[model samples]
Target: MRWMSTVPASDCGRAGTKSSEARLQVDAWVAKRGGERAMAVRARARLVELVAYARTRSPYYRHLYRGLPSKVTELAALPVTDKSQLMAAFDDWVTDPAITLERARAFAEDPALIGRPFGGHYSLSTTSGTTGKRGIFLHDARQWAVTSAMATRMLTGWLTVRDTARIAACGGRTALVVPDDAHVGGAVMAARLRGRSRVAALSVHRPLEELVEALNDLRPAVLAPSASLGVLLAGQAEAGRLRIAPALVCLGAEGLPMAEHARIGRALAGAKVRATYNANECPFLSYSCPAGWLHVNADWAIVEPVDERYRPVPPGEASHTVLLTNLANRIQPILRYDLGDAVTVRPDPCPCGTPGPALRVQGRAADRLTIPGADGTPVTMATRPVAIVLDTVPGLDLFQIVQTGPATLRLRLAPAPGIDPDDLWDTVRARLSGLLVRRHLGHVRLERASERPQISTGGKIRPFIPATTSAKP
Candidate 1:
């Protein structure tokens, strides 16, 4: 609270190297005001500053904002930046021209490079190409500190101070379920966690069974894993196949559906289940507000929802693309960088009364599905809804359900290590089959694959992908 009281109102729109620092200052100022209106004003001012920075520091922004108005009254006045745009100028767009795609790619390809910093100080990570193109991102020291602070805020915001104190009292070990390879985000997280002796790091790409075994052996009170995988573990608890009573469960990387939330909650024997919404492209974005609404960390990163033309859409209106500006990572200079996820802004103030903007993501734009309706008509299915069902099942950690044909579907799964592959297939097939008419499922076949899974081009994974057309519905 004291931190919020220290925010400087003018810092809300200040650009350049001190953006994050200034954003926090603005946060303190908003906190001092003691309510929602103050936060909204701060958010508006912060957006203005972010656009100002983009117009000046980012090449992509210069082209996007060639003749924009002097004042950014609406977020739409700013451009809707996308992945292709930022990547085109990947080399020039970064604050540091020395960090190139070739250099980042080469660094990411080497597994041995895991846990090592890139360019002497910056942490490097690569995106899993579920969206078709892999991305390389960097986080400077300040960004890391900001991210850590925000993460702590997220956790504490979910649990009461007393609960947090009690959880810490247990000396609960944190097991981060993330990619272990040299891909930028996972590697950075792995490095930092490994450096901390108390926390344990586990690879999400590994078999779910093995991950479960490790969890059982370690008995960590903190369970932080990708949302889908967390749901899988919850399912295992439902089936009596696995059990762990962690004090907290933080889900990320996928949407946590209400159904899956119930399952995970039940599986955890009443433990709190919270969601973290972030990606490799931008380190600190939003955390779930106390009211369970995802609130953007407007002080650190600026997120804009834009239409096809890159113009901002009305709040609560659907966005085809998400443009992000990372205030913390000056080394990469991510000004209005496009993140490939479809998101919607919450239309109203949160019950929790946080001043930051609230969001309800429709899941990654890539995760939706297209299939024939029950009447034989083509139907576009959204994966966010279906994935909720998949996550409730136990043992299946990573999955890709590709519809090879209208009636023929092939499911690729990377089960928990040491799990009975046959059992996983049965559970997944049964759950998936039930989602549709029994006849449409001509034959449900499951296979094991080795590729690491990630959210698709739209910044989320497609639980159901139509083979004929590559686009997600």
Candidate 2:
């Protein structure tokens, strides 16, 4: 707080742009090779520093940590947090006074402000309703620099000398197959990297044939897409319709069966497919090794697998959910925030030889929808972008999508109290049909199921169920 007080809040963002990135990158490089002990030292120092600052600067945290000591090094000493509590008190939750919940939401909804900074120096992004509620986040330049540096460290760990040569041979072009919307993280990243690097964003909403043609022409050296979309492209490549030779197939995916990964590798033949586990909440959460374990980046962030009672689950056991604390993000400090994903920490050291903790996550993989196109051919779409469309619908307490056949879907939903279920269903149908028609699937039939949305054995309700699912819709 003292440091922030020295300069005006608006000017503080500008101060941390270039110099902060260079410094953080250097620190990341050191932490990469410094081993677990070194990382623990840094993590301890950052934990104490951030906790102190958050308790003093953030009004919500100030009251929450009222009785705690001035310095908090142990993460458990802090209470757990989630989206609902913080979002409800959003105006007082942030450290900065300039940010308001309504204005920040308005800024996030504006498509023109996608990659542009808010308050001239903050990165703004909105999350989908996958967690039963939406979220809006802001990252100042300092936090953005740390996120960039952490991602760089992961890239260097995944790519080898041969892969580097392959990237260079193809003019270093990179294509990210993601939804072309401001609310999407991949698009924000692609937009941010335009002049700094060679990157292209191919929207999954485009017709299947068009997406394949665009990839054929780009022939990017590095291709990154959602796991399901990558599999779809693998099929196209095997059919000889897509012909790009990528040295690295980086999947922005997690919790997928190893067979799906192998299928892509077998189809591409020479490309190395790397799986990553990331969320809009914490972008640099973890990355995968050849041993198929996700390694957590614990130097600057804390990951704790907890049970239903918020007790720390022992290693080698699966957890009911996980908690995340982002030491890098100060503008909106995420301290022991409930991320709502199941993960298991490995009891032994990983075979990959990295000293960091290894984890196995569950319930992060989503189903893909294959609807029949107007021409009789089937068109498969990743559930992610489709989520972006449905998440925009307002006033629904619960909703679910179930694909019954090639051209038919069953919808299950519960409207919020005092709202008309029919009106909400109409909005859902119209928006879903609009999305399908835009993707050339106007012939797809939608049905409103009499049954309500059901929870899985995992104790959570999935927003979308695939055609092969045994779950009743």
Candidate 3:
């Protein structure tokens, strides 16, 4: 009987071991209590305490909060601070004065050093800055624990009660499909699943054929991918190539459009499709409720919507910009950080009955583009709307395309290095042109910029901005 019990062959390599039985057991423990109000209560208490600490320890915040609200609740009445202020005082914003921008950059740039904390237990990760400037942030051990709990809630919430059981029984294989490089989320996901031998890390930056093949073969029970990538995979699944019927599909990093959501839902054949609101500036902001409504974590973070004057907007009104205060992370206290993404809190209660506030998020605020039709009419394409089509483009990572003219366009593509720019341009041109007539393709120049692109207030990425409009502005 003892001899009959042997090591499972699936628990072998680094990729395979990423989703092991041991990790799955831990995941079960986390999932069981991840969603309770008690968790949020505990997290909020810690967060309020962290805020007080930041006010004392952080040089930047110490001065910023000089006038002060006596209590943490007074934070809502205070003026909102944008990214510019926090970034301008980059050196003094964090609790640890020793962790400089240079040190953060050095650690983030080194692929080998990722997942290895900065000083003992300090984790570092940077945002893609769909706003203007990319932001670097830090997390400590306690923050990591809260982050883990939040992640469990987001990931496991996608699974049905039945699916959760199947996941546990089938050795619980999970797969994280993202870039192969050291993306902070990818690094965290990889590190979390390191002990799980059944988990596989497949790179979305790979060719479509390769990515699809790997997915069909892996048959991962827990499938987590970016919203755009998930839509593209859904196309493949509809085409009958990718065959895995995942129990859960957790979409993150970018907004999941309605069309793409339906496509993925059909492709997965009743598997739960959900959104995770996370930015490098503030990770684990919210999760999709069982009924598909996004519920703010309100536990580790506070999401405050502000108007033009940085005053709190009414519950139903969309915010001009979002201000976030990250609670669990004291190593780098993020208070009133202006996340360029636009969001509106829904006035009504969620059907899912989650106590947290309900929200409707718009995609990146920088990538909004508009183009002129062949009929001498302007066809406005919002980034959030076109994200449905962009979801189909394979191996496409970060990108920004502005229409230089009706027929001419300037494209800024941050594709995976070595990918053919011509192919991406051709694909984009075809999509943009297919909607318009007599539309001559312009000089789709591929260049790199120092900053990440932004979407407009229209809640979309401007894929093609007419050259004529900028001249007037």
Candidate 4:
């Protein structure tokens, strides 16, 4: 939810749509070239410009690159930047000198400032820290407008003429199931689509019954939700409880299993499901294709799927982690930035025939937990609500909740630097226990584990380990 871009209520100005159209046309032209080398050439040129601008503006980059050559034309020439490294130099990482970490932190945390721009020009957003490294991102109006336009392009690609007619008949209403508090994305989408369509915002944290009822009432023509929420709603529809028939169901924030996506698609009366690959740092990364690959927008951004030692991994092989470079956003230059996610770049061009690069996501997450209620019925919990409860716990970014038993659960945490482990545990226990009590899940035992969060087969930390699975991750 906080991962989505928020444009101003003024629709990012009238020029926004025109600029978007222009970007779309440029992207189309690049794709038509249908050559990876061509896309790489453009990305390399942009990388040179971005590197020059970042070195001149950002003190952090200037210091890091002080030993570098006068001209950096190759992507591999620059050093890799990680979250910890960049965040440590927070005050100087951004190109803008006026945007301080303290004020940006305060702005992103305030619910009242969710949709509002910072300094009346930049929009503030925070990442959920799925990889155990939370991040705060700032985008200028032009950057956000690019995000908004890219999003529009993605949706337009997904929707068919029949889908468009259906949406129009349904009053052009769109429903967004996003994080309740840190939902800057939902508000921005609503404001951006104003007059053209009505976007109803719903929380992913709401109880299953409540969420279903809300959807039924809204009866939205277009629906976008986290993967877990969509699956739960699919279950309700399978039981003949939920009856709304949407024209499309776009998945974001989390991953959806193929079986679940198929089931949900059938249950939702064949609404097409499109999963997007984006982040707070790079909002217009890639969009999923029916062929199951995410086509990277190489003209505007660069992704290097690399090995453990920062070496480029061969095609068809999964990389230890991927690096992202956002060329469209010069205010906060993200150049060869370490994005901690496992991915595999395809050896062959996509069958969908889109130009540039395509890849498979190795660590797309799905956080869903179901427990039996006091009345013998099951209670379902998704990522957003659980993230709201646990992500706020100070000194805790790397933690895992494993359902050890029908009612017993294990909580493993890795405290941040300088944080008292015992103190962090005590605070997290209290917060989680309170949530359980409120949700009538107090009977579920919360066990404190001596072990830290386990590394998954994909080499990332799994946030929630379901009871149905006996193995870790």
Instruction: Give me the candidate number with maximum lDDT.
Output: 2
User: Which stretches of model 3 miss by more than 4 angstroms?
Assistant: 1-48, 69-72, 154-158, 168-170, 365-400, 403-473
TM-score of 1: 0.70
Per-residue lDDT tens digits for candidate 3, residues 1-473, read 00000122222111123344344335324423454454455445544566678888899878877887756654564556766577668788878877787677667666666567686657776544554234567766545555555666555555668878867764678788754455356555576566668888775545456777887778887788877567667767887888887777878777755656767878877676777787766676788775655777765577778776677887788887788877656777777777766788888777776656778787442232344444544433333323333433443455665654454455565555577866766775575444333222132233334344556664434444444432210
Instruction: Tell me the TM-score of model 4.
Output: 0.87
Q: lDDT: which is higher, 1 or 2?
A: 2
Candidate 2 per-residue C-alpha lDDT over 173-292 given as tens digits, one digit per residue, 9 for 90 to 100: 988886665565776777677675678888767877798899889889889988878878888888988888888888874466777777788777678888888777777777888888
Q: lDDT for every model?
A: 0.62, 0.77, 0.60, 0.73
Off by over 4 Å in 4: 1-38, 183-197, 394-397, 414-440, 448-459, 470-473
Q: lDDT by residue for model 1 over 291-364, one digit each (tens)?
A: 56777776556677877667787898989777776655556656566676678888887788665678877744
The candidate scoring highest on TM-score is 2
Error of 1 at 400 (Å): 9.7
Instruction: Compare candidates 2 and 4 on TM-score and give the better one.
Output: 2
Give candidate 2's error at residue 36 in angstroms.
0.6
RMSD, one per candidate, in order = 10.4, 4.2, 10.8, 4.8
Q: Please, what are the lDDT tens digits per residue for candidate 4 over residues 214-307?
A: 9999999888887767877888898888888888888876665576777888999888777877877887788887777787877667889999
Summed backbone clashes in each candidate are: 26, 0, 30, 0
